[model samples]
Target: MKERRHFIRIVYQAPAQLSQSGAQWSATLKDISLHGILLSCPDGWQPGDDPEFQVDIVLPETDVHLTMTAELVAYDPQSLRMKIVNIDIDSISHLRRLIELNIGDDALLHRELEHLADLAEDE
Candidate 1:
């Protein structure tokens, strides 16, 4: 089945948190869409659990900073990976633009293109 959600995957090293007073953890963003983002952090989160976090995403071309809140969505013990969900879309547009620019030629971009075409056709 085709992926219903479109995401731009990128790898970056940044500081993230699970709570206001929680410990800071290093994380790598896996993918991002208009509404949310997915990231991999150290093995410290559980499925269905929500943990607030902040992440700084560097724009690819401009090196601009985009910071936003993220919530823990899932965790894998075998890979020691945590999937984070970003909630702030407006605050991260620059980062998304950077990702789109970098990923314009990728297969994932084609998928997103197809999804957009479908949406347009539906409308």
Candidate 2:
């Protein structure tokens, strides 16, 4: 099996109501991909349990806010890190532009653009 690559960074506040037990916490995203994100939170969370939460990502070097629904896919108690999955495309697009701009690299952006172009060509 081949390993997959991710193309985004997580940077935002943790969702308001994530648990029924009133365990509210905040986290900062370390990296993000279209599929999921790696976040570091103050409290420890468990994997396999779905946590209903929202994430706010400010576009790098800008104030554009991108918010979306995220589910906890995996967790590490020692590291206090978790993997959030099921990010939407709209949020991905917005963050992609910001990453391209702030990072000053168009590789990923170009790849996405080309993918869109290919889809358009097919249509």
Candidate 3:
């Protein structure tokens, strides 16, 4: 199948947490992009009727933690895919820099930032 992703995915594993309905679970980060994230499914997590999640990823060897609210997009037995729906300015800045360093293309990163901004404007 042809690739359908618009954002470049960077593989950066980190410890993460997911929260929903006042409960929290530990999860392992698989990868991330400007638009979404892939994480190992939290133990005992069931989709059911809940689709929104609060996520926090703590970068390894750093004091940085990127937090965002994401909507469940898809999932399988091993992983959960989420689309970033909301993020604060500070978290987004940190995530942007993280992506920039991993992506290694200033122009491409800038274009993606513009697209992200446009998406926010449309919402």
Q: Which candidate is the best by TM-score?
A: 3
Candidate with top lDDT is 3
Report residue 89 deviation for candidate 1 (angstroms): 8.1
lDDT of 3 by residue, 1-123 (tens): 999888899998999999999989899999999999999998898886889999999999999999999999999989999999998889989999999999899999999989888887998
User: Which of the two candidates, 2 or 3, achieves a greater lDDT against the reference?
Assistant: 3
The true-structure Cα RMSD of candidate 3 reads 1.1
Q: Which window of ten consecutive residues has the lowest lDDT sum in model 3?
A: 41-50
lDDT of 2 by residue, 27-113 (tens): 555665444556675465544344655666554466555666676655675323334444467766776665566566678667755
lDDT of each: 0.53, 0.53, 0.93
Please tell me which model should have the higher lDDT, number 1 or number 3.
3
Q: What is the lDDT, from 0 to 100, of the residue 63 in candidate 3? A: 97
> Tens digit of lDDT per residue, candidate 1, span 1-123?
987444555554433333334555555555565445555645664444335666665544554666767554445653223233443555545655655776766576667656645755776
Pull out the clashing pairs in model 2.
Answer: 8-32
**Candidate 2 minimal-lDDT segment of 10 residues:** 12-21
Model 1: runs farther than 4 Å from truth?
6-19, 43-50, 59-63, 78-91, 105-123
Best-to-worst ranking by lDDT:
3, 2, 1
